[model samples]
Target: MSEVTVTVRGEHETRVAPERATIRLSVRAEGSERSPVVEHAMRLTEPVRDSITARKESGVIVDWTSTRLSVRAERPWNNEGKRLAPIYYASIDLTATFIDASDLSIWVSDVSPWDGVEVGSVSWHLTPETNARLEREVASEAVGVAVARARAYATALGLHDVEPVEIADAGLIAPTASAPPAGMAKFRGMVQESGDMTGASMAYEPDAIVITATVEARFVAR
Candidate 1:
């Protein structure tokens, strides 16, 4: 009878600075009627557009847009009671990109609206250059970790050599954030705050994103 043998697993990690970032901006407005609400909401586009343009000129902003627009009616608590006031709302969103770290920081500070506007959230991303560099570093780290573990296993088994039979390189895992999932509330808020051209504050915070990768290797006992 022939005996079977197996090798243990190994792992390692490497950290690198991120290069690229993606910013998501959302604007909302509301009113009693769709037309009025849309009108007010549309006005927000100007300021938002200006903000993006300014950032772009400074070389901090990459892209901006009023991608979403929604309109809805305000419902009263009591169905039987006469509607006290009809409400309409609309929302606008913008996205800005920056390459330099200092520029990115400045952009975040500048983009924050003190009034009449809401900052949904902000996120950081790894640029292609950073991503590629990290991939190589991580792969090397992983291989080093694997070899270390393999050496330990071989020593325990009193083996002189171990051969790598197969290596599975599972590329990097891009980072992502979870959206509100529903746009109804977002739209409603925009419409409700339509009249307040000054701006409104929203309860949202930027999230940190982490990119990762993994690999699997098959080794043979020699």
Candidate 2:
């Protein structure tokens, strides 16, 4: 049998400032009929579009797009000749990109009318510039960590010198967002609030995203 070889592993984490923001907004409309539900959904989504446009005009929002549109109908279930009400609902989802910190915060705070509208999720991002800077910082830190670990291992093994032979980056980590599925009733409530231009109590708190990277290194012992 061949001699066994031992490989060590090292990990490091760094918290870098986020340079961009992605805000996900879901607009919904509901009514007794499909046509009216769709109409109301469109009407309610107008303000959300307007809000995004306003932010763009004010140089706060960088980009915006409608990601998804869905319509759902729920028929009343009858048992023992009991009658129930039928429901119809529609929903629209949008994503707005913010490049400025102040604007991002303002948009998050001001994107109200949330009673019916469900704030799906929010994600922080690293802009190209910030990403480049962080890459360099993290790489340096990772190398230091690897070297320290190798040194410790070499000392424990009674080795005098340790030299790196290979270094390969595993990959970079990115932030992602996931929203819970919504039903017709929930969609309709959001649309109604927006269409009626009524204000409701809605509070949202987005989680912070932490990005990480890993590396596989091979070193020779002397």
Candidate 3:
């Protein structure tokens, strides 16, 4: 048989447990007076900040940050449609990364009931080194799949040899290659959170991270 072109797409996916959890929290206070609100937010934030710094030193927390205190004022309307005096709000946002998920749960449970502390969300992700390693492995496997597919096509055509002509990401080998496919290799992190009101307790749930890689290849069969 004469040389013929064969194009195929290969994909690989793997799921892994997350290695890090980053949580966001805000300390907020509101009142008819601006000064007291600001002071109150700052006071509530001190213990939270202390806990994060202590955890960082103990290696339970990898990193943490705090935003400057901010204040906003708004005049709310009552049922009578009368504009009331402006109410002042003060807030500060804080974020912390925990290497251990259990530590995150413990810390959140401790701070959640504070007068002005609010838990926002938790992000679960893999370490950079692990993600890179797994992505490379899956990409190589995808290439192998492309080769096997080309060989199968050659066999069906009564040919015995297949050789790779070109290889690119999921979109690069075809006329439609300009737009990369969504299945292409990417770094992804999952944001998940849950809570239970049982006895005023708290809970956290983080899903597994999934990595997928796709590639396109062109081969000659004869």
Candidate 4:
């Protein structure tokens, strides 16, 4: 009989194969003598850096970075309760980004067994352009969901058309404090893993990226 305010939340999610992968690894050297640790570390790290540079030139690697050498000394007690001489450890951390997941797997397999090389986890993601496009589309779909639900509620109440009053990201509409503007998509979720993109020689495959969007809206229904 009269206009009523309707508030609802909308959500949408989509899964897509990852378009990029970043490999993290470190080159480490430890020796009882302190003077030679840094040299050994540098020597061990050079090949890895060269490989990444070559890949970058050839367009296989999108980007790469290596940290300065880190050196530390530690002394430990022996089994007989006697303290052993100080041991010096040096390490360099490097990360390389690849546009192809198969190439990442190949690079990881090639470097993982090298002396002083420790391969870390791989991060899977979509390019910024791709993510932005998907996020906008997903946000639009979420708005549509909100509209459809509002209409359903009005129809159930023997009402006619519904008009939107306000819309904001999740929590902004009802929260007390001023919340930061959440992106159209909050996070890129890694939901599924498949080896189809990588060949048999590859060490492993990357997980799929999930784009999710949520929104809250208020409407007037009659």
Better of 2 and 4 by lDDT: 4
Model 4, range 170-200, lDDT digits (tens) per residue? 8889773533333465555442332233223
Per-residue error for 69 in candidate 3, Å, reads: 1.8
Model 4 regions more than 4 Å off: 175-182, 188-201
TM-score for each prediction? 0.68, 0.67, 0.89, 0.88
Model 2: worst 10 consecutive residues (lDDT sum): 182-191
Considering only N, C-alpha and C atoms within 3 Å, which residue pairs clash in candidate 4?
none
Predicted candidate 2 versus true structure: per-residue lDDT over 107-168, tens digit per residue: 55555544346565556666667666656665666667767777787777777577777655
Compared with the true structure, the alpha-carbon lDDT of candidate 3 equals: 0.82
User: For model 1, what is the alpha-carbon lDDT of residue 167?
Assistant: 53
Highest lDDT scorer: 3
lDDT of 3 by residue, 82-168 (tens): 999999999999999998888887888788877788888888877788877887887888788878888998899998888888888
Q: For all the candidates, what are their Cα RMSDs to the real structure?
A: 9.2, 9.7, 2.6, 4.2
Ranking by lDDT: 3, 4, 2, 1
What would the per-residue lDDT of candidate 1 be over residues 56-109, giving only the tens digit for each residue?
A: 787776655557676677766567777667676677767766566566555545
Clash pairs (backbone) in predicted model 3: 171-177
What lDDT is reached at residue 199 by model 4? 26
| lDDT, candidates in the order shown | 0.54, 0.60, 0.82, 0.82
